[model samples]
Target: MTVSIWQADGTQPVREVDFLVVGAGIAGCASALFASQAGRDVVVTDARDIALGASGRNAGFMITGLADYYHKGIEQFGHAAARELWALSIKTHDYWRAWAREAGGVHMDQRGSMLLAESLEEAKELELAARALNADGIEAIYHAADPLKRGYFAAVEQPWDGSVQPVELAQAVLRLSGAEFIANNEAYKVEQISAELVAVHTRKVIFHARYVMLCTNAYSFTLHPYFRGMVIPQRAQVMVTEPLPDSVIPVCGYSDYGYMYYRMTHDNRLLIGGGRHKFFEQEADTTDDRVTDGVQGYLDGYMRRFFPEVNARVDRRWAGTMGFSADGVPLVGTLPDSPRIGFAVGFTGHGLAFAAGTAERAVDHLLYGTHPGALWAGRLTR
Candidate 1:
């Protein structure tokens, strides 16, 4: 199963490694980093060029907590579990920051997330949600009117959430760890070659290893068919405005529970994302990166509606696909019967903050047979 990827140049043979990881996104890189840290010979490869998937195309919003809001998380997963998840999210953010520092630091933007309500009723709901979260020891502030703006938009602020350059962060992790990265390589199927080893067959080469980790989010089905309905791939589009005027848009802001989001980068560029839900059926498919004019129109309309003063024009527009699970929480840890295989996917659009930590903890469990205690402990297949 040799596949060709653009910009991928290299020739290698069927080789053996202590650990083999698929997908070059953050999860795969983090897994390789952990395995190498354990003094294990590791090989990490991906179908496309490194960081060319959701990891590279993501909005890079470094949010705190799970995919669900902190307040909603408590109701969905209970107070104790939600708090535990929040703690782990903070820890993961710290881990990424440390990794960035070691690798010359990431494009770090400490700007917080602003949640704007589209209507007054939604504003009240947001206020209640913020109060609930604060009562549960989380930091969230509610505003009756968007203080950052002049008009009637109500909003809430989460001081902990921030943003980063997705591709730069992944590249930094790979460089700092010095892991063997085989880009433009595709692993179609993984077969268990032995009790403690698996074989990953690509088009040009075969990689045999003691363990194989699937970190390819939406494309997980290509390797593990069982993940079909369990992990759905949804397409998302993002557009970046050419550097804007100094004081045009705020650093970060989102509307409708993060469905439509826009932020002004440090360089004064407006980065906006989210329009998949508009074309739900088309967006949910596993294949397809084509951007529809309808979706783009909606995004443009959203920009105009929010930033009426600034006539921002998009300098770059791209599409990314993310994994969404049934429960909204990430599927971390190992598979039920296959201890030699571990994965951390189904991030549900919450990959940036937790993917690194999930991979580290997953590899620890795989190599050491010890389990971690957090919201992700028993949430996976195991």
Candidate 2:
């Protein structure tokens, strides 16, 4: 079933524009804002509402670089290409610092992140990876967290990482006065009207535009058949605890890399998420965000095992769906030289950290006909 947090106001697109972007997630909102600023008439819409999918439902961690370490990225791509990707990811992160401020301070924290491992061998690999990332200018260090001495793992602390409320950040960006946001409306089809015009079909209306950008992330399967083999949907589970007493649990940081992450909210509630890969086949759809006993049981065990100091009950449980790509990187670019078809999707669950910058660059390519930062564009062009 589709999930909605914002009701659509009575606004329908009855006229033509320069651009129409589908999917109001981070990338869509970013594209809408940039395209509008570029003097292109722009309209942004989503299937349900803004920030309703992975945007609102993620755990909100912002660790630097891709899901893999520097060495792994090098292994996948060549050394020079990997280095450039690393530098660009870091640059995008720095750009995020300024973008957040422009979007009215989007709740970015610098509380750091810890990478834990269960075995000594895994710890050695992490240490080696940390060294390589450090050499590549990433500030990751091998430090065994005190929490892990109690059996979490030998860990590495990346000082530049932190968390945020992703949906709120996307909403703040959408508040830009120049962009038109259409909520509760889904894009049913895209038909080219002419060389300079295209039509975006919703359930009720067909909106016309000169350009169409697909920033729908995992939901792009309906529009792009290639995404089926490139990007696979993965569901992540999360739980938030009731606000504990101030001194009871000094809620400060976050843990886990691609799985098993938790952070303390401003209200003093502990929000934790992970454990979808544990039940791989069952989590590939955009269905119920409700938690299951198997996943919840693991989360409960994680709490008891790592955070035994604060024996708090789970106030609420929920799940969020994220797209995991085959090569573990986002795909952002035009649909093979089609002037009217631009797309930014397949984030593989870590798009929140760099989505705005990625979308901005993608829209720049759409507007200028070529991207200045060819490295970022090429990295995501897959």
lDDT for each of the candidates? 0.77, 0.70
Q: Candidate 2 on 134-208: residue-level lDDT in tens?
A: 787767778654444647556777767777778777887777725787787777667666777777767545787
**Which candidate wins on lDDT?**
1
In terms of TM-score, the best-performing candidate is: 1
Give per-residue lDDT, candidate 1, residue 301.
85
Where in model 1 is the C-alpha error above 4 Å?
A: 1-13, 150-153, 372-382
Residue 43, model 2: Cα distance from true site in angstroms? 1.2
lDDT of 1 by residue, 52-139 (tens): 8899988888877776566788888888877877777787788788888889757877778888887787787788778888887677
Clashing pairs for model 2 are none
